[model samples]
Target chain A: LEKEIAAKDQRAHEQQKFYPDLSGEIAGAVSKRSEPNLDRDFDTLDEPVWVTVKRDLNTVGAKFGLVLFPTQGNQSLLRNWDLWGPLFICVFISLLLHSSEGKMGPHFTEVFTLTFFGACIVTLNIKLLGGTISFFQSLCVLGYCLLPPGAAAVLCKVLTFASEQSSLLFVIRLLVTSVGFVWATYASMAFLAGAQPPRRKALAIYPIFLFYFVISWMIISHSH
Target chain B: MTDLEFQSFHNQVVTNVQPIRDDDGGTTYEFQHSGDIDRVKLLDSENGTNSTPQGNKNLWSFEYYQQFFDVDTDQVMGRLLNSMVPRLKTNFIAQHIHPIPDLYGPFWICVTLIFTTGICGNLAKYIETAGSTINGHFESDFHLVTGAASAIFSYVTLVPFGLYSLLWYRKSEVQYTYLEILSAYGYSLTVFVPVSILWVIQLESVRWALIVVAVCMSGFVLAFSFWPAVRGDKKLIAFGTIVGILGLHAILAIGFKEFFFDAALQSNKFGADNADFSSGALDKALTDPAPNAALTLNDSQSKNAKGAEPKAASNKADDKESSKATANGAPVATADGGGQKDAAKV
Candidate 1:
C-alpha cells in the first residue's frame, strides 16, 4: 500500500514537471514587486485575450523563423491553412508594386482570381488523388509555395524598368527569374510530397509545375 | 533404420538452409529499421520546440518606440559607423544581439542625407547653369524643396516597403523580422551619405566610379549580414534575394543620376535658345566693328538694314525732295509779290 502511494506521488510529480508553472510563478513575482497582497490579485487576475492572441502570433513568428531555417518544427506550421499569412502578404506587396503603372484594379483582381483558382485546382487534385492530407493542408502548402513566384513577379517589375536600356539586364532578369522559378518548383515538390499517394506523385506534381510555369511565363513575357 | 537416417539428414539440411535465409532477411530488416530510426531522430531534432515565448513588446507600441529611442543616440551613431564595414559583429548587433528600438534613426538619417545632397546637387547645377548664361539668370522648373522632399519621401517609403515585401515573401527562409530587415536596409543607407556627397563632384567618370563602389559596398554589407542565416537547399533563393537587393539599389542610383544630378540638365545649358542668343551676338560683333556698335545703331538704321534695298533708296529720295521744297518756298513767295505789283501799275 505504501509502495503504491509512493508510486502515485512520483507520477504526480512527473506530470507536474512536464507543465511548468507558466502563469502563477511569473505573475506572483510581478505582483510581489508592486503589491503586498499578491495572493488576492493573483486569484482575481485573468490573462487578457489579446495576450493569448499575441502569444500565439509570437509562436507563429517563431515557426516562421523555423521555416526560414528549415527545421523539423517547421512541419507543424506547414500543414495549417493559417500559415498562408506570407502568401497574403506577398499578394499585397505585388499589388503595391503593380500600382506604380496605374490601372491596378484589374491587375489586383486577376492576381486574386488566379491565386484562388490555383489553390482550388491544387486542392481538387489532392482530393481526387486519394491523398491523405486535408484540403486546407494542401491549400496551405500551395499558398506558401507561391511566395517565390510572387517575389519573382516583384523583381520582374524592377527588371522591366532596367531591361529597357540594357539587353544584358534583360538576360540577367531572365536568369534570376528562372532561378526563382526552379527554386519554387523544387520547394513546392519537397513541401507537397506528403500530400500525394506514392503511385500518383508525378500526377500531383503536374499542377504545381503548371502553376509555376504560368507565373514564370507572365513574368518573362511582361519583362520583355 | 536406413529410411529414418535419410529423413533425419534431409530435415537437418532443410533447417540449416532456413536459418541462413532467416538471418539474411533479419539483417536487411534491421538495417531498414535503423535507417528509419535515424530519420525520425533527425526529424525530431529539426522539429525541436516551435513555441517561442513572445514578449509583450509590440512593434507599433509607444513603449517599444520609447525604449528604442531611450537608448543613447551615440549607440546608433556607432552602429552607423560600424555599418560602413560589413562584418559579423555589425550583423550580429543589428540582427541578433541588440534590439534596435525602431528603424527611425537610421531611416531618418538616410532621408536627411538624400534630401540634403539632392537639394545641394540641384542648387549647384542651377548656379552653374546661371553662371554660364548670357544674362546670368536661370530658372528651374524643378523646385528644389519640393523635389527633394518628394524624392526623399519616395525613397523612404517605396524602396523600404518593396524590400520589406520581398523579405515577407521569403519570411520562411529569412530569419530577419520586418523590423530587422528595415533596420538593416536603413543602416545600409549610410554608404549613400558619402555617395550623395560625392555626387556633387563635376567629373562624370569619377562620380560614376564612386557610385559603383558605394553601391557595391552597400550591397556587400547587406548581403553579408543576411547570408549567414540562409541555409539548406535555399541558397538559390538567398542569391536571388541578394541580387534583388543590389538591383533595387542600382535602380535608386540610376534614379539619382537621372533626376537629381541629371546629365540632361547639364547638357541643356547649350540648348537651341542659348545657341540662338550666342549666334545673334556673334553676328552683331562681326557686322559692327565697335564693341557697342550694335547697341548704338538706331531703330531706323537697323530696320533699313533688315528691309529691302529699294525701300532704303526710296526713303532717301523722299528726304531730299522735302528739303528741296523748303528751299524753293521763298522764291515762290517773291514771284507772287512781283505779279501783284505789276497788276497795280497797269
Candidate 2:
C-alpha cells in the first residue's frame, strides 16, 4: 500500500507537469489580445495572408529598428516579417531623394525599374534553387537589405553638394558603397538561408551578389 | 467515485468557483479559475514569483504621474544619487523582485524628466536673452517646445537603436537583451536632468561643468553595464564600445547645449552688446544735433539757394575741419562722419 501510494503521487505530479502553467497561459492571452487587430486565423501555418495596415506599420518600425540595430533586428525579422517591407521603403525613399539631387535625375524611373528587375531576378534565382520562401517575402528581404547602399547614396549626395567629384570623395564613396554592397549581400543571404537547400545555398547567393554589385556600381558611377 | 478520485474532483471544483451571496437576494457565482485572473495578476505570475513587493498598478501609467512619484520614489532617489551604479543592478534585482519588466517605468520617467527639464532650460535662457536686449524678442515658444520634443523623440528612438546595432555587430557573444541596453541608456538620462537645470544658470562655465558631469555619468554607466558582458571577448571590442559610448555621450551633451541652453542666443547677445557699444559711440560723435549745428545751418542755406555752389563748397570745408576735430578725439568718428556724408550725397 505504501509503494502504491508513492507511485500514485508520482503519477499525479507528472500529470500536473503536462498541465500548462496558469500564469503563463494568462500572460500569453493578454499579449495576444494586445496585438493589433490580427485575424483569428493568423496563427494558421499553411495559409499566407495579405499584410494589414497595423502589420505594415509594425514592419516599418521593425525595419527602422533593424537598420539601427542589425543583430536584434535580424533576430526579430527571422522570428517574424516585422520590418522588411518598411526597411525597403525607407531605402527606396532615400535613394530617390539622393538621385533627384543629381544630373541624372531624369533617369530615376529607369534606375528604379532596373533595381526592381534586379530584385525580381534574385527572387527568381532563389525560387529556381529550390528555396521555399514566398515571392513577396524574398522581394521584401532583398528590398530592405538595400539600406546600406541607400545610405551610401545619401552620403554621396551630401558629398556632391560640397564638390562635384574629388579624388578623396571618390575614395570615400567607393569605400562606403563597397561596404554597403557587401553588407546587403551578407544580410540577404543570411535571411534567405533557411529557405534555400543547404548544399546549394552558396550557389543561390550568387545572384544576390551580382545584384548588389550592379547596385554598388550604379551608385558609385552616378556619384562620380 | 473512489476516495482519490473524489479528492481530485473536489480540488478542481474548489479551485474553479467562488460563492457570493448577492444583496439582490440571489446567489451569484464568481469564477475563481486561473483563466479569469486580472492583468496585474497575470503580470505578477508571469514574473514567476509573487513574493516580491509591488507598487500600485497605476504607477507605470502615463496618465498617473503622481503615482510614479509614490511608487518609483526609490528608483528616482537611487538614480539621482548614484545614477548608473544603482541602475546597473536592476537586471539582477529584476530576477527576484517584481518580475514585470520594471524598465518601462523608469524609461518613461527619464524621458519625461529630460523633456520637462529641457523646456524649462530653454525658457530660462529665453528670459535671460529678453532681459539683455531692448528689442530682442524671445524665440517662439512653439519652436522651443517642438525642438525639445523632436530631440527627445530621436534620442529615445534612433540613438539607442543605433548604439544597440553597433554593440550587437561588434560583440556577438554579449548576453544582454536589446531592452536591457535601452533601459540602461534611458536611466543614464537622470544625469541630464541636473545638467538641464544647470543650463539655467546663464554662465558658460556652469554649462561646461554640467556637460562634463553629464558625459561622465552617462559614459561611466554605459561602460559599466557593457564591460562585464563584453570583457571576455577581445579587449579591443570592449575598448571600442566604451569609446563609442563616450562619443555618443559627448554628442548628446553638445546637442543639449545647442538646443536647450541657447548657445545661439548667447552669441547673439555678445553681438548685440558689441553693436551697441560701437553704434552708441558713433551716434554720440556723428549724429549729435548739437555737434552738427553748423552743418545743419549750412545744409538749410544750400537747400534754399539751389545754385549756391560757393555755399556748398564752404559747407564741405567746414565739414572737413569739424571732422578733423572729431577724428583727433576718436579715429572711428571720422569713418562714421564719412559714411554719413556718402549717404547724404546719395
Candidate 3:
C-alpha cells in the first residue's frame, strides 16, 4: 500500500512538470501555423499614413530639391529622365562647352563659355603679375567655371592636376602640399569647427589626400 | 717685364715678330707670355730689345709697357651687358601663363578670385554708363588686362583660404577656435556671395535661368564648402544648410510670396483701360511685408528700401523676418522685383 502511494506521488510530480499538453504528433505544419508579426513592419515605415506621410513626402521633395541628389548609389526607373538625368545632360554639355571654350569662344557656346573666357583672361593677367600661375592653374580656374559646381568642381580639379599633361603640376603639388600643411596648421582652427579628422595622424593622409583622390577618380570615371 | 727677362725673352721669342711701328706707325705684336713671377723678378721680357738683365722687381712696373701695348678692355663690358639683359628671343622669353579651366583648385583659384572681385567692384560703374566706356584700343586692352588682373588678386586671396583648409601642418599648442574662425569665414563668404549673385543677375536673358540655377546650386555649394564642419555626423550639416536655405527662401517669399511661387501671381490682366499688376499691386501681393517695412523704418534706411516699403503704417514692426535678415549677416536688401540688384557674393 505504501509503495503504491509512493508511485502515485511520483506520477503526480511528473504531471506537474512544465510541459504543454501536446497529445498530437509533431509536424512541420505546426511551425507554419503562427500569425504573421505586423509590429516590426509598422515600426520601420512612414508612420501616420494620413497627415504625417503627406507632409513628409512634401518636405522630402523640398529637401531633395535643395540637396545635390544622392547623385549616385541608388538606382531609379527614370535614371536618365529625372532631375539628375538632365543634370547629367547639362554636365555633358558643360564639359563639351568647357573643354573647347578656348578653341571656341563666347559667341559659340555663349553664356558658359563667355564667362569662362572672361575668367580665364583675368587669370592670365594674374599670371603675368608673376604669382606663379601654371597650366593646371589655368585649367583649375577653367574647370571651376566649367564644372557644374560643388563636389564636381573639386573632382575635376584633382583629376586635372593628376593628369600627365598636367598644366601646373608643380604649382598644384605645391598648392596641395600647402593645403596639407595648412590643414595641419589650421587643424587646430578646424577642430573647434568639429573637423577632428579620425586618425589625423600622418597615416590619415595616405588615405585622405591620396586614397580619396584615387577613389574619387575611380568613382567619377565609372560614373561617366 | 723685367730687363733681364726682357733680354732672355727676345733670345727665346714665341711670337711672329713685327716692327714696333707700321706704315704710319701702328703695329700689332701677338705674343704668348710664359714665365713665373719669380723668373720675371730675376729678368725682364717686355724690354727684350734694349733693357739690361736687371733683377730689379721695379723693372716689371715700367710705364713704357702701358704706352706700347694695346690691351683689350671691351670684353668685360660686353660680358656685363650680356649678363644684365635677358635673351628675349629664346626660351628665356617671358613665361606664358593661362588661367585654369574652371574656378577650381588653388592654382587658378588664386588667380580667379581677384578677377571676379574687380569686375564686380566695377560693374556698377560699368552698367551705369548705359554706353561703351573706354580709354583707347591699347589703353582699353591695357584696361582689360588690368581689369582681369584684379580677378587674380581676388583669386590669390581666395585660394589661400581653400589651401588653408586643406593643409596638414599646424602650429603651436593652443587649441584652435575653429567655430570663431568659421564664423569669420562666414563673413568672408557673405562678402563674396552678393557680389557674385549681383554680377550674374545683372546680365539680361539669363537672369531667370540664373535665378533657378542659383536656387539650385548655391545651397549645395554652401554645404560643400562647409563640409568640414559636418564631420561624420552629416545630418546636422544637412539640416543646418537646409534650414538656412529655407530661411533665405522665406525671406524672399515674404516680400513677394505670389511672384515666387507661381507664374500667374504676376500675370498681366489686359483691359481697354489696361488694369494689370503694377508697383502698387506688387506691394499688395506681399502679405507679410509689414515686418520688413518696419525694419526699414530705421534711422538710415537706404533709398532703395523706401521703394518696397509696405502700405501698413505699422506693418514693419509686426513682421520681423526681413528686418531680422538685415540685422543679421548681409547688407540691407530691398524688395528686388525683376530689377538688377546691387548685391554680391564671392
Top of the candidates by lDDT: 2
For B84-191, candidate 2 gives per-residue lDDT tens digits of 353444332223222222343344445455545545655575567666765553332223434455555555555456556655665555555555555556666766
lDDT per residue for candidate 1 within B68-146, as digits (tens), equals: 3333334556667766675543463344325654554454555456545644565557556655665443333223334
Each candidate's DockQ = 0.02, 0.01, 0.00
Instruction: Sort all candidates by TM-score, best to worst.
Output: 1, 2, 3
Error of 1 at B239 (Å): 1.4
Could you tell which candidate, 1 or 3, scores higher by lDDT? Answer: 1
* Candidate 3 chain B lDDT trough over 10 residues, lowest sum: B92-101
lDDT of 1 by residue, A8-34 (tens): 556655644443234322223334334
Q: Which stretches of model 3 miss by more than 4 angstroms? A: A1-224, B1-104, B120-124, B131-215, B218-238, B241-346
Candidate 3 residue lDDT tens string, A91-114: 453443233322211122433343
**The best candidate in terms of DockQ:** 1
lDDT of 3 by residue, B281-311 (tens): 3343332333443331221222223444544
DockQ of 1: 0.02
Q: List the residue pairs that clash in candidate 1.
A: A68-B172, A68-B173, A72-B46, A72-B47, A73-B47, B68-B101
Which stretches of model 1 miss by more than 4 angstroms?
Answer: A1-224, B1-61, B88-98, B139-144, B156-168, B171-174, B233-235, B263-346
Residue B240 lDDT in candidate 3: 37
